[model samples]
Target: MSNYTPTKFATALLLSVLLAACGGNDAPAPETPAAEAAGTAVEPTTAEPALDAVEGEPALADAPGGDPAPADPGAPAAAMPADAAGLVAGRDYEEIPGGKPLEPLNGKIEVVEVFNYVCPACAAFQPLVNSWKARLPADVRFTYVPAAFGPRWDPYVRAYYAAEAMGIAERTHDAVFNALHIERTLKGERGEDSPAEIGAFYAKHGVDAKQFASTMASFAVDSKYNRAKQFIVRSQANSTPTMIVNGKYRIKGTSFENMLENTSAMIARVRAQGSAAE
Candidate 1:
């Protein structure tokens, strides 16, 4: 019998509530057609839709070995689908002022997804992100930036950089999520897991447990983790699963599917602009 209990469920629910609170508030419903027919004058209101999380940058270290390398600037851009056209700014997405990527573009369109392992929403979004990432064109580079929203979340941020530095991040990414949310082997926000425990979890993946724990607190990991936090601050992102495209556009959508569609379109747009500049 599984030992999973409401504590995990409650933790996720609480974090979700926090995510909703920090991100944009739910937009007020527009006047319904029935209300209009009733001759009630409804004032127009403008508000941004709620994002997944919002809490709110620098050249990040090179991605772990598993990520696809950035595409050549001269490489052809992917075809822009019809659905990508006419996306409303501030409605479908928001433009970041003086935005920049976490890493030097070096001619590739960059996409950074801000996430935290403790974020229930991010865990839910991972499978979708993976599928979308697999289809990306050669000119696009996707990176994951973990957020340490609080003390409880900070260790995982350290762990992520440590794992990345060790080149085990790619293989261990999903497993970490599963361990916390599915397998219940690792406590997330409910009860903190020590560095040694986390390292032990990665041991199953073939890394030296003690070395992994040491790396979690190493200077390299510290630098990378801080850089990620800086980039998140620069991007003005406060939520999990937030996607920034080329550091120019912050993707927003009514739903996850919409977010992905907007991201694909934005990638195409950036690629087209780059092609034009040449």
Candidate 2:
């Protein structure tokens, strides 16, 4: 057994190769079509569907933690409620009078985006809305308020905050979308690139590994979500991509640009009325 001829060595190598090939063949095929389809992550749609807020338009089929915001795609919001003062038609959404109430920015115009990472619609709105965000007047301070709606939403939201906590938002925010929508990677799906998977993605992009893990579980991140929740509950946002101009009006639109336009108008409208801070 210790001494072998060149031909014997060659024979042994061939046998080993054959055994490896057999092992490869023995592995089972992937999950079946139906099973895979159900498990497969949904690729984000290229174009957004026409959103009708009042006509009972179906809510997003998926919610992160709770029910989708109540939007009736059929019946438009009731004409801003008769008693609503200082609000405008198709302009300001909420109705709390007084020249643009103060915001978390310490009296600056507060524009908050209540968004979820898993929502295709929110992903679609980002590029267009981001442009307006970039152009927001100096007096304005915009904030991103990621929602924690359900189990599905947490991973994405956590990934976002985790990256931010690790100070890698600039690097990972867009990459996350590209990962999920463009590359068709199911980083969101459990077991693959789950939260830990996303965290790894961040680490690859230069995020501090320890920082990423701690940020994911940090109370500070939880506080951020809590603040977002309270903002919606108090403002009665009731919809994704909602904007509150100076806390007096809610602005929403079919597309991000339109929402931005309406938001700008609401801001000016409130500003013209005059600032009312205590």
> How well does candidate 1 score on lDDT at residue 191?
72
Candidate 2 per-residue C-alpha lDDT over 204-272 given as tens digits, one digit per residue, 9 for 90 to 100: 688766667668778987766555555545555544445676655667544455556667777776556
Q: What is the lDDT of residue 91 in candidate 2?
A: 43
Q: What is the lDDT of residue 238 in candidate 1?
A: 62
Top candidate, metric lDDT: 1
In model 2, the runs with Cα more than 4 Å from the true position are: 1-87, 90-92, 96-103, 189-193, 276-278
209: Cα error in model 2, Å: 3.8
lDDT tens digits, residue span 179-263, model 1? 7756668877657789999999999998999999999999999999878877776777766678998777899876566788888
Task: Estimate TM-scores for all models.
Answer: 0.70, 0.61
What local lDDT score does residue 240 receive in model 1, on the 0 to 100 scale?
A: 66
Q: What is the RMSD, in Å, between candidate 2 and the native fold over all Cα?
A: 16.3
